[model samples]
Target: MQGTSYYIPAAAMAAALAFKVPSLVRAWRDPLLRAVCALLAMAGLVFFFAAPPTIAKVNRLTGVTNFSAPLVYALLSGFSASCLVLLVNWRGGPAERTRRISRRWIAGYGVHIVLLVVLFALGDTPVERLRDLDTYYANTPYIREMIVLYLTGVTVAGMTMNFLCWRWALQVHGWLRTGLLIIMLGYTFNTAYGAAKFAAVFARWAGKDWDALSTDLAPILASLGAQISAVGFCLPLVCQRLADTWHIWASYRQLGPLWRELDKIAPAHVRAVGNLWWSSAELSLTRRESDIHDGLLSLHPYFDHDVHARALAAAVAAGTDPEQAQAMADAAMVVSAVRARVADPEGKLLKSSDTAESATAEGTRDLVRISAVLREAPVAAAASGHAAMPESEVH
Candidate 1:
């Protein structure tokens, strides 16, 4: 059961690392991405080797009674260093400063790892204790020092992360703030995990037995902390990508009415060929916008200024804001022009109109509003009906 708990989180971290691999390959120079990948990989390794089954397997494979002890400690130290390095890059600053700070953390943990190995080698531990190594060797010669050093390193890192994330969360908003808060919570769990382990080890030194803190309670806390921290790191990034995709697709869908109308009048050469199956939503929207502009250019000669003026006045009278009034006016003129073009199939009404050109020059939000007005505004529908009347009708 304990092995299953460790393995499950280890597998989850492996999955996350797999997802990040392609992006890291594409942007290998991205320090933040590199740090994220390293942190995830180190986290998985910590859980994998720390599992009792794996620890027993490694000890047997190496023909050493307790080799897994220093090994897991070194991995945890590396994991702690990884967390600090990731934090440095995630916060971001001047390039040189980030690199310098990251190097210092790596070097510091590198020394701790060497000391753990040296201490473990000097200590004499004939007995193998997979689940409660810290407590089992609490009073041993150099193994005791090894236990204190690794736990202290983890505790310091956890507390430092909690402080930094808490302070940063205060100044941020949206998903970023939410992610930071989650990270803080994760580190709080991690800090507590370190405290639990320390308590169990110190209890053994004081002629008491509290091995449950290390064997039973601490592992549960560490696993939960790691999994929660992984979510905290990934949530904002994944949510940001999803949010951007939603916005792009929403814009593309909103422009549909205008794009369809433009497609009807735009020449084959000017119109987008077909649905670009391979194009991204952003590119598809860009092409649709281009096609609408071309259609407006083709319809320029048939645009009626009088229709636009009357529609603008009616929209303002109806309490539409100035921006929306302009869009309504533009939509009325466009619908009127389409009707006028249909009525005069001979193309004899062709003449340049600065009014139409200016409407065509209007930006995307205006185009979106014009598209909405086409769908919902009575003024635009009325203009289309009026333009369809005979050229000699009471003029």
Candidate 2:
């Protein structure tokens, strides 16, 4: 149960890294992207190495008693540094200042990791304590110092992250603020993990046994915090891409009516832009709009000014808004034009005096409105019925 807690978050962090690597490679110079990938990688390593099964495996593979101790400590220090550096990049400032601050944190944590390894080498711990290593080695020589260093580093980083995110969250709005609030909550759990471990170690120093706090409680807290923090880091970036894809797909769907209406009159020579199966939503939407416009141009020769004038006056008299009235008028003209072109098939409509001066719909939005009225408006339906009457019967 305890080991499962660590492994779950480890797997989640690995998945987050997989999702981000392509973006990192594409924008190699983006400091913020680099920081995010670094944080995710370091976080995964910390969780994987901190698991008890992994700790025992490392000890066996290296043939050194408790060798996993210094390794896990160094990984924790690295992860702590990564979290702080990522926060620094996320809250941007002047380029030089940001870089300088990031470098300082990296160097400081680099030295701290080295000292942890050196102190572990100097100490003697023949007993392999996987879960309760902090409490177990609390009184050991240099091992004690190594444990203190890692715990302090993680605590300070968690507190600092919570402080920055809370302050920034209060000033921002929308998705960014939501992400920050989640991040702050995650780090609060992390800070509590550090406190739990420290309490267990202190109890050991006072001749008492509270090993469950360090062994059982701390891992649970750390796992929850790490997983929540990963979500907070990813939410804003993922949400934006999702919103863009949704908008593009909706625009494409909304244009379907107009595109189909235009498809009936499209000239065989126009060679419509084809959207391949694997094409992106944005590309497909653009192609559909282009095809609609082409069809509108081909239908222009059949437009009747008399049909447009009557539809426009009737729509206005019916209290339609100006924009919608214009759209209805254009749609009625299209309906009459399509029928005339079908009836005359030999270009007779092009030679008529009733052909409109300006007949084609102009913009994508206007085309959409015209397409909508074709299916719903009474004026367009009336025009369709009137155009179906024979020319000799009208006289």
Candidate 3:
């Protein structure tokens, strides 16, 4: 159980580090990313040192019985310091203020770390007690002080994180708010873990047997808290990336009918990109929009002003607002232009001056609105029918 608990947090930290590395590589100057990465790395180290098998191996390799205790304590203190700094960096303010705040935290935690080392040195625990180190040394001289100091530091950091996360959660929205809430909940577990350890240690001092709280229960809470907090840190970034991909895919799919109709008239305008289905939706949308513009340009000669005038009258009669009616009319004109081009590919080309201003203006409007019209408007169906006709009968 101990090994499994230790490994779980170790794995969570490793995953967090993996998730942050690419961003760190791209922008090493980003202080928040650096702080987060450092926090995860230190956390992984703490769990690695705390695991029983690894602790035993360190003791054997160093030839100092129970030497891993001080090492693990130091690493835990470092992890606490890193975590506190990360929260500070996350809740950013003015540059100088953030820096000053970070420095103050570092200095304060530095004192706790120094005290941890000093108290560990003053303690005399020659027996190896890896799994039950806290309970075993609960009544020992300076070992008790070291344990209390470490727990105090951890408890303070955890409570501070909980307060910051909860306060921030209430002010934010969407995934960020949810992530902060989860982080707040994780820190609640962390504070409870600290309380459990303090209780068991105090029980020992009082000559009672509440060793299970420290030996078993606290570790479980710590492991759960670590894993949950790691996930909370990552959730917003992951959700944002997923949302962007979904938007891109939706745009690509929604723009398909218009793009396909335009492609038929001006295949030459299509970029020579391969396997468009597998290409990025953003890139495909860009290329598709470009192709539609080029297709409209090619059909400029076939742009009949009468077709646009008739479509506008039909749309207004159908009760669409003027702005939307204009879009539908423009859509109908494009359909007529496509049919004219198919019917008479080599006929006399219409002069650019003869085209309605709306036909040219359509190129500059939002493609989404145009796509919506193409997919949903009544004139769009009429346009599609004309576009689908056999080339010989298109006229």
Number of the candidate with higher TM-score, 1 or 3: 1
Lowest-sum lDDT 10-residue window in model 2: 386-395
| Clashes (N, CA, C under 3 Å) per candidate | 0, 0, 0
Better of 1 and 3 by lDDT: 1
- All candidates: TM-score: 0.87, 0.79, 0.84
What lDDT score goes with residue 126 in model 1?
97
| Candidate 1 residue pairs that clash | none
By TM-score, how accurate is candidate 1? Answer: 0.87
RMSD of every prediction:
3.5, 4.6, 4.0
Better of 1 and 2 by TM-score: 1
List the global CA lDDT of all models: 0.84, 0.82, 0.78
For model 3, what is the error of residue 69's alpha carbon versus the real structure, in angstroms, after optimal superposition? 2.3
Q: Which ten residues in a row have the lowest lDDT in candidate 3?
A: 386-395
Which candidate tops TM-score? 1
Residue pairs clashing, model 3: none
| Candidate 1 residue lDDT tens string, 324-361 | 88888788777777766666666566543335454343
